[model samples]
Target: SEPFLPFTAQKLVELFGLEAPDWTQAGNGQLLKESSSIGQMGLLFEKIEDEVVEKQLNKLQESKKMNEAANAPAVPMKEIITYDDFAKLDMRVVTVLEAEKMPKSKKLIKLKVDTGLGHRTVLSGVAEHFEPEFLVGKQVTMLINLAPRKMMGIDSEGMILMAEDKDGKLKLLTPHEGTASGSTIS
Candidate 1:
């Protein structure tokens, strides 16, 4: 409830049978007669409450920062994508008809693959682990519908997927026993 004891002159006029005195006209008179001394305690308490709210906001922000750091291995900050978008990738099993070391390039191998549909020439950078002669005639998995990338005057139709070995070398991904070329890899 409000402070009821300290009533203004207008309020006192309605409470007590007295005409309100206009301070400007009554020069010698004071309307409030006396004012309530609520004191500085209320003002000081308000400032303390404001500081507590600020500390709570800071604590919440710190907790958010700690949670983000704890989940760093999960890559939580990466952009979200839909499953339909991932399904758009066209991957197929293709037989490596020929493989050869690229001229002047250390890790690049020019491989000609037979995708049951047609022949596609792709320049894969996986020569470090696979010897061209050994890789030939092997059925390897390739991304068939990838955007064509041109390198050394060759238009690479698709990307040949590879895995990273313990030595940090790229190992060509191949299909298991007897999966013929042009097989749909789901």
Candidate 2:
């Protein structure tokens, strides 16, 4: 009786209670899982409330989101310019007649464009953004009156208008859908 007074696994199995000792297992007086190994200390964390767990999970997700956002690309700085300098250039929407990659250059691409005025050859640093088949039919804005520049041994007649995004991706300046082949942008 004296030995059984204290509740041990053997004494509890023999105790006369409404519930059977074998039906329910109590923690073995340690914060360890029952089947713990000798060298390993297996401790059970208290069951947190569902709301608390959910909140912690959300916080981890938000922290990851912030880190990903912080690692994003930088946006280029904008410059201030006079309207007179801006208005001096003539920009027109022109259709590409032909597009082909340059012979010896990776960044340069040759483009034949119809500017309503005439068909002109324009070279662009746009080999990365455009495919020859896709570019041939796109009506895009261009600096129609730029001084000719030689690229890869070819005289480029004009420059195409392209916008650079924050991620450093170049996008062509295209008119609204159904726009004609040649139109004045100004």
Candidate 3:
């Protein structure tokens, strides 16, 4: 048999010992349960271990496991900072009174937060992760002392903190229990 070309559809079918789809039977929907294209691809992938030589198959399986492990979520710690630097940030708990998408901005969501400091406007780039309706009434950690900046023409007074996953999902940092609005974090 001839060597298979890398990543080719024929090679994939051969590598997996899967029956190649009969293109003529595609529209008839008789080949597989899934949509015709996906059904055939799934069947091909399913037979991979069977088609590949035992030693090479074992190596491929190991490589796949390593790749999956490499994709696991991990965040590298930031460079160490002095206590004085840490102490300078006025981090506090704040309650979200309202969240609204900023006009003309794809990523910005303007939030009305109640920090014991007062009801302040904060702009966050989390529109992709959160809906305006979902943010209301959530208590979150914020850096209340950050200098005001204009975003989407609105004055953003603080920043909300969030934990980000490797795949770019963000989870806002909220206290484990109810805390008063504007409670100091440290």
- CA-lDDT, candidates in order: 0.77, 0.76, 0.82
Candidate 2 lDDT by residue in tens digits, 82-146: 89988998988899989999888788789999998889999899888777788988898999889
Model 2: number of backbone collisions: 0
For model 3, residues 76-117, the per-residue Cα lDDT tens digits are: 779999999999999999999999998888899999999987
The true-versus-predicted C-alpha distance at residue 155 of model 1, in Å, is 0.4
Clashes of each: 0, 0, 0
Weakest ten-residue segment in model 1 by summed lDDT = 37-46
Q: Assess candidate 2 and give its TM-score to the true structure.
A: 0.59
> What TM-score does model 3 achieve against the real structure?
0.62
- Would you estimate the TM-scores of all the predictions? 0.56, 0.59, 0.62
> Against the true structure, candidate 2 has what lDDT?
0.76
